[model samples]
Every structure is written in structure tokens, then in C-alpha cells.
Target: MSSRPWTILGVSTFAQTAASASMSGAPFLIPALHHQGLTVAQASLLVAAPVAGVMLTLVAWGWFADHVGERVALMAGLSLTVLADVGAAFAHSHLLLGICWLIAGASAAAVPSASGRVVVGWFPPHRRGLAMGIRQMAQPAGLAVASATLPAVAAAYDLRTALLIPAAFAAAALVAVAIWVVDPPRGERTAHVATNPYRGDLFLTRVHVVSVLLVIPQFVVWTFSLVWLVDGRGWAPAAAGLAVSIANLLGAFGRIAAGQLSDAVASRMRPIRWIAYAAAATMTILGLIAGGPIWVAVAVMFIASVLTVADNGLAFTAVAERAGPWWSGRALGVQNTSQFLASAIVAPLGGLAITHLGFGWTFGLAAIPALAAIALVPVRDERPLS
Candidate 1:
């Protein structure tokens, strides 16, 4: 009870988790829409809003965290996100839905920036890897909640209530952070200094490169898995949601274990490389196997989810360590920006891929990024480009 900021971290984690869980509603959406008589054109636009919203503001949030400090950024963003979520629930027009989702996407950035800053600030350099890893678990945990509960809630109650669930969750995080998250005191002069990583000799050039490379599959599988399960394999939304939820449960543990392994191993990238290799191989195999049987496809995706995401913790830790303290926030922000930017692209492309190339070949293309990430793991710290 005394060490309760961690619980605050837990709440912060929940906010992010809830935001991510929103994708679960994607698969359930059309059925709920039958009552509204939404045309394909309108449904497409609404489905695209959250993805667009997240991409639009992710960089802004990162920049703010790099300059202003995470606590202020997180509180501000969380407040806006709560507003966005609640307001979206009541939105009656298509235009309002898009506007609400865009705001929600933008607001969601606050927690990651602030929470990451907290882990970076409090944890020592060596242990920072593990701390950051623990923080990443929020995503999978949130995805699990969305996948497991959101659709069911929508079916039993209504889509508005389902949307409200995550809104309330984000609100809880806002209140918890307000009460519990303590910012490290900086000298009046150095407070701004702590926010940016550009000044130092310690900027992580290799870490940055690897970060951009690694985020591809994580983003791909994350954004595509449920849609792939439902569209490609013909699984019901409820079933697909459950499968992704299980995959996310595995991912939550994978984040912690990857971080610990990064600290314990003599070489940080070694285990990371192995995880990348596994993800690539799994994707390739699953992509080829997708046409064979539904159960087989389901099993393959679940396995691929585990292998693909296991490296997220190690990746963040590597960037933080390589950047050192002065540059950690900015370094991580750059890392996130690259990855999430890719995530932004992946969603629409995935939709197009399913629309055009069919899921089999599009999924096969995703494996290419995983393999590229695996190949890059051999690179060591070259001189900092910065």
C-alpha cells in the first residue's frame, strides 16, 4: 500500500490498455450497425476514424512530453481522452463520430508519454529496461479487455454502453494519476533539459534504427489480427475477439519476460533477435497455412501473436539504455513515433489488402517486415547520427 505510485502506474497502464482494447469493437461493429441502416460508405468512414485520430496526434503528444514533462502531458491528454470517449458515445451524426474518435486518438497519447517518463525517471539505468517492459504490458492487457468484454457488452447492452466502459476506465486512470503520479523535481533551469534527448553524446543511433524496424510486425499483427481472424478465416467476431484476447494475455507476460531477459543476458539484442526470427517464421507459415483450415489458422495466429510481440519490452529497454537518461524520453518518443506511424499506415493498408489481394498474400507481405527486423538485430551501436 505504501508503494502505491506503482498502483498509479497500474491505473495509467489501464488507461492505455482500455484505449487499445477498442479494436475489439471493430469486428462487432457491423452487427450493431444493422439497426442504424448504415451504408458501407458511412461504416467505412467511422471505422477509419480512430486509426486516423491516433496517428494524427501521436507525434504531438511525444513532442509535448519531450518538452513539457510527462505528468502534465499525461493529465492533459487523459482529460481530453475521457472527454472524447464519453462524447463519442452520445454522438448521433457521422461527422460527430469521426471528430470524437480523432480527439480520443489524440488524447490517448498522454498516458504513454507520462508513464514512460515515470519509469525512466524512477528506475536506474540497468533496471530501466525491465521497468519499461512492465509498462508495455498495458497494451496487451487493454487489448484483452477489449477483445473479451467490449463486444459482449455491446450485444447485451448497446454500443454506447460498450464505448462508455472504456471511457470510465480512462477516467479512473485520470483520477488515479492526479492523486498518485509524482513528478521528479528538476531545477528550474534543468526541467526543460530533462525533456529532450538531442543534446547528449548518448543518443541511441542503433537503438533508434532497430526501434523503427521492430515496430512493424508489432503494429501489423496488433492492427490486423482480429480482422484477419474474422475476414480471412471466417471466424465469428465473438470467437475472433476471444482468440485475440488470449493472444494479448500471452503478450502481457511476454513484455515482462522480454525485459527481464534483456537485463539478464550478456547481449541485449540476442534474445530480441530470436524473438524476431520466431515471429517471421510464424508469420510466413501462418500466411501459407491460412487457406487450409479454420482451426489451423486460429492456432497459427495465436502462436504468431506470442512470437511477434514478445520483443516489445526488450526493444523499449534497449532504446532507453542506449539513449541514457538525458535523451531517454526523446529517444523513446522517436521510437514510438516511428512505430505508431507504421501502425497508422498498417490499419488502412490491411483493410485494402483484404479488399484487394486477399488475406493470404497480404499476410505473407507482413512476414517480410518481421524478417527484416530479425536481420537488423545483428547491428551494434554505430556512432550516433545525432
Candidate 2:
């Protein structure tokens, strides 16, 4: 176990954090946007814009990563994202802001799709689960930072100033990756090797479907958590921000733990299936208790939040392994594309449902996708080439 792998993991994690900052932090901007006169539904669309951008370009970036390499793809993506973030910070109108966020989303797609390839390439199968888990933590960790800081920053100054936070992160990540990250060595593939992973395998298909289904609940909860806390439960803005930040922080740990669990059990599907079941159970419970006491609803939401995102590392490890080194980037892109597509839908739709249906019914409806994910996920794990 050389320190090189860990170094790659550390740098990649920072890169992911930077890449994801804008979209993950978008929720934190909602309160300020609401104050600026956007309705919940409109604000939700703002949150969904970047994700929509990511959904659109994820596969292309993944393909680029596979064709070129992780380092180049990551550097290019982060650089573009930084420009988008800066443009977003200065945008005067909602339309301009949304366009900038859309660009940010498109560019940031490079980080997750490529970063996963980096981890899979650098670490062995035995240790890859944990490495990937740590890598996966970057999303929630970025969200956690945004949740904790962005609201207050926006409150203190303005939305534009707060937007610079992600820009700074993107710049820092660009520097880190440019200097430290390198792609692992690749061996020549045989002429008979299949380049397109979707041809004969149902594994990637099932994993992608399950991940897409699972992301609905994840984004629904994430996009509206602060509003739900403040408006639904009567908490102050700062307190709600703190609660969501804490949940995201815990979600990061959950990713790491879920990865280690897969490694310990020597099966990726098991942990993912377990996460789906757990997500279903928790989300169902959340619906049941949605109108209950504030403390109780908060507790249930916390559980649902943690369980919803816990499957990322597990499913990602499964996908990367099944795709092998050859198609890992594109496969991961497809996987994330599906999930982000689901997420793009979840944000605005969930917000609309919350506006019309109330949190109780909306949460109950959100649980349906988690239930679907449980049925969609494969029962057994696929074996990967060493």
C-alpha cells in the first residue's frame, strides 16, 4: 500500500468537492433566492438547472475521460466550471444565473465521472471499495460546506458574493489536480475486447436503473430540506442550515461505511440492496411521521437523508468493476447521467409537489422510487478483472 494511491484519493476528493460545489451548494442559495422574490417552484428550478446541465453532458465527459485520461478531463472540467461559477456570481438576471449554473453543471460532470476512473485505476480490487467510498464522499462533503456557510454568506452580503465560494473551491481544485493528479498505467486491450459495455451486460443496466430510481428520493430530500425545516417545522434559517449541513456530513460518513461494508462482505450488490431497502424503510417512515412532532420529523428526515445517499460508493464500485478499466469512464458517465436525469426531474417536481401536496404527501410519494430501486437492484455482485 504505497502512499501514492492515498495521495491520488486525497487530490481527487478535493477535485470532486470543487467540481460539485455549485450544484451541491445550490440548495443553500434557495433561501436567499426566495428572499429575492422567487417562488419555491422557481427556486427549485434554479437548483435543478445545474443538475440538468450535468445530466446533459455527463456521458460526453465520461467518454472524453475514457478516450483521453482522468487528469486532462478533470483539469479541463474544473477550469470550465470555475469560469461558469465566476460568471454565475456576476449574473444580474435569473436567466443569466441559470445559464451559468447550467454551464457549471456541464463542466462539473467531468469530476465524478473521471475521478471514479482515477480511483479504480490506482487502487487494487481489494482496496478499491474504500478508496471509491472516500472519493464518493466528495459530493456530500461539498454540500456540507455549502450548507454550513453559503446561507450565512448570502445573508451577510448577497447571493452574488456567496456564489464566489464555489468559485474559490473550483480554483483551488484546479490547482491541486493540475499539480498532483496522474492517470494510472493502462495495458493494451485485445482486439476482441468489447468497447461498448451496454452491448451484452444487464449488470450495468440494472445498476444504472437502480441508481436512477434511488436518486429521486435523494435529491427530493436534499433540494427541499432547508425549506422543509424552516417553513414546515418552524425552525430558523440558520438552524435549518445547520441541520441539513449535519445530515450531509453524516451522509459522507455513510458513503465510506457502506463502501467498507461491501469490501467486508466481498460483495457490492449486497450493500447497495441493503441501502435501497433501508432507504425505502426510512423514507416510508418519514412519510408516516411527516406531520408528527417537529423533533420526530426531523429525526426521520435525518435517517432518510443518510440512507438515501449511502448507496453511491457501493453501486459505483459495482459499475466500475463490471465495466473493467476499458469502459469505466463511459459506464460511470452513463450511471451518473441516469441519476442526474432523475435528479433534474426530482428537484422541480418535488418542489411543485411540496407546494401543492404538502410535505406529508410529497414525502410519501418520494418513497415510491426507493421502493422501486429495491426491486430493480441485482441480488448478486459481478466479478471484476484484477
Candidate 3:
């Protein structure tokens, strides 16, 4: 492949990293907000607000990408996210803050929906798993950034000021997308395309269902990691933040590794199936040792975080390849929408579980979806158009 595709991947990664910063940063703010005045339920709702927003518009953004192309879609989405982040920074009340984050979430949906299309369009089938893996790294990369910086920023200045960090990330991504990203050439489309991906095969449906199931444990860990570290482990918030940051950093590498593993094995579903099972096992172990020694808990959480995220690149590649170039955007959008909807539920449900049932039981229960995902993965792995 030409360097052009790599260039596009670089730009998309930056934009995705920026888009993830704001949404991922929200969970880090929960402790600060709870300290200020909000109840655990209210803070959990705030943590979930962006994902809820993403759920509302993921398909729309995907459709927009299909119609207008990746560059335009990403630019518009990032621009809107920048505006929303700025508004969120100045928000005076929790309601106003939630509203702004919701808008930002909806806008940020464009990054994943469109960027996946960009990769599938530019890279050949043989190279796509690695490319998608690199592209998928954007979220964890952004989350790592947020985990490393947001807690300290919120601690030193205040939660409101901390909001500016992601706003800056959004603005940076906006500029990058405007200057660098280009839609792939039109010839990438397959000859006999479906009018909509949903109409043709059960492949896309299976991928979507598995993705939703897999996301439950991922979100449960992401949503509660910092608080669990601090409250359950009795570590300082900053120290907990550092651990989460490390986990996210490792998770980024895990995504790339999983992608390469798929490419090596020549089967996307193979790697994803293994990842799901690993996620279930690790999460179960983490649940069992929830109040164990600090090193042990951190070790299990780190492993769980890596395994939970490892499936994204593999699953995304499967969807894009199956959907073909024509429907890649919308198919990916649907995939993400399903995952985000699950993620939106996870925050509140996990929060309530943490409050009432304790982290041990919640972590144990979170593993069931991963087990379900393992069962779902045996459905056909071939591209729908092939």
C-alpha cells in the first residue's frame, strides 16, 4: 500500500484520539463531581451522558459518512464537538453540563463511524486488520491521555477547567481533519452492493450483537476503574488515575496486537473469540480478588482492561469487510450504536451495582456478557459480499 493510506490512518488516529479524550475524560471527573455535590447516581448519569448521546446519533453520523464521505463527516463532527466541549467547560449546572456532553458525544460518533470507512476504503483486505487495529487504538490512546492528565487537572484547578483539555483535543482534531484527511477513491466499492447492509445477511447482525455483548465488561471496567481503585483499594485518586492511565496505554497496544494476530491467522473471528473468552476469564478473576492485595488487584484489572479492548479492531474489521465499501460507514455506525447503547446502560447499572451489590459481584456479573459474546462468535466469519 501507498504511504497515502498510512497518512490517512495517522490523521484519523489523531482525530479519534481527540474525540475519545472528551468522552473518556468524563469518568475521571466523577470523583470530583461527587465531592462537589452530586450523588453517586447523578455522577454516574453524567459519566454516561456522552455515550447516551452517541447512542442517539451513531447511525445518523454513519449515514452522513456514507453520503458525504469521511473527510466532510469527520470535520463537521469534530467541529461540533469542539463547540460542545467549550459549552461544557462553561456549564453552570449539572443539567447544562450533561446537555453539552450529550451533544459532544453525538458529534464524536462521526470519528469512529467515518474513520473505519476510511481505513476499509484505503487499505487492501490483507492489510486491513492491522490498519483497523492502528485506527482502533485512537480510543484507548485518548483515554490514556485523559487518565494521565484529567485527574490532575481537575485536582489542581477544578472540574470545569479540566473540561478544557478535551475541548483542546477536539479543536486539534478539527484542524488535522480539515488539513489532511481525504476520502478514498470511488473505485473501492464492490460491484453488487446491498441497498442497506441490514437487508442482506445475518453476518452484520451477528457482528453487532457480539460487539454489544463484549462491550458490557469493557465499559464496566472503564466506568468504575478509578473509583474502584480509590475507594476499594484505598489508594490516592492521583495514584489510581496513574494506574488507569497505564491500563489504557496497555489496552492501546493490545488492540494493535489483536489486529495483527487476526491478520496472521487470516480469520478475524478467531482472534475475537479468543479475546472474548479471555475477557470473561480475567474479569471473573478480578471479581474474585476485588479486595485482594493492591498489586494483585491492579494486575488483574490491567489484564482485564487489555483483553476487554482487544476485540474492537478485529470486530470492526469484520464489519467493514463484510459490509463492503458501499455500506461500511453505516454498518460500522450500527455496530458502534449497539455497543454505545450497551455502554450507556453499563454506567448506571454498574454504578448501582457498586453502590448496592459491591464491586465484587458487579465484576462477576459483568463477565456473563463476555461469555455470551464467546457463544455468538461462531457464526460465519466470511465477508458478506464475498
In model 3, the Cα lDDT at residue 201 comes to: 62
Worst 10 residues of 3 by lDDT: 377-386
lDDT of 3 at 28: 83
- Tens digits of per-residue lDDT for model 3 on 235-343? 7778888999999989999999998888887889888899888999999999999988879888999998899999999989988887767788888888999999999
Candidate 1 lDDT trough over 10 residues, lowest sum: 377-386
Question: lDDT per model, in order?
Answer: 0.67, 0.86, 0.87
Off by over 4 Å in 2: 384-386
**Superior candidate under lDDT, 1 versus 3:** 3
Q: Pick the candidate with the highest lDDT.
A: 3
User: What's model 2's lDDT at 247?
Assistant: 89
What does candidate 1 score on TM? 0.85
The candidate, 2 or 3, that scores higher on lDDT is 3
Residues 19-104, candidate 1, lDDT per residue (tens digit)?
A: 66442234335435534676433454466566566656665676677567767887898888888888888988768866877778
Model 1, position 230: C-alpha lDDT score: 62
lDDT string for model 2 (106-167, tens) is 99998998999999889988888788889998888898888888887888888888899999
- Which pairs of residues collide in candidate 2? none
Q: In candidate 3, which residue pairs get closer than 3 Å at backbone N, Cα or C atoms, i.e. clash?
A: none
Off by over 4 Å in 3: 188-191, 379-386
Q: What 10-residue stretch in candidate 2 is worst by lDDT?
A: 377-386
| Candidate 3 TM-score over all chains jointly | 0.97
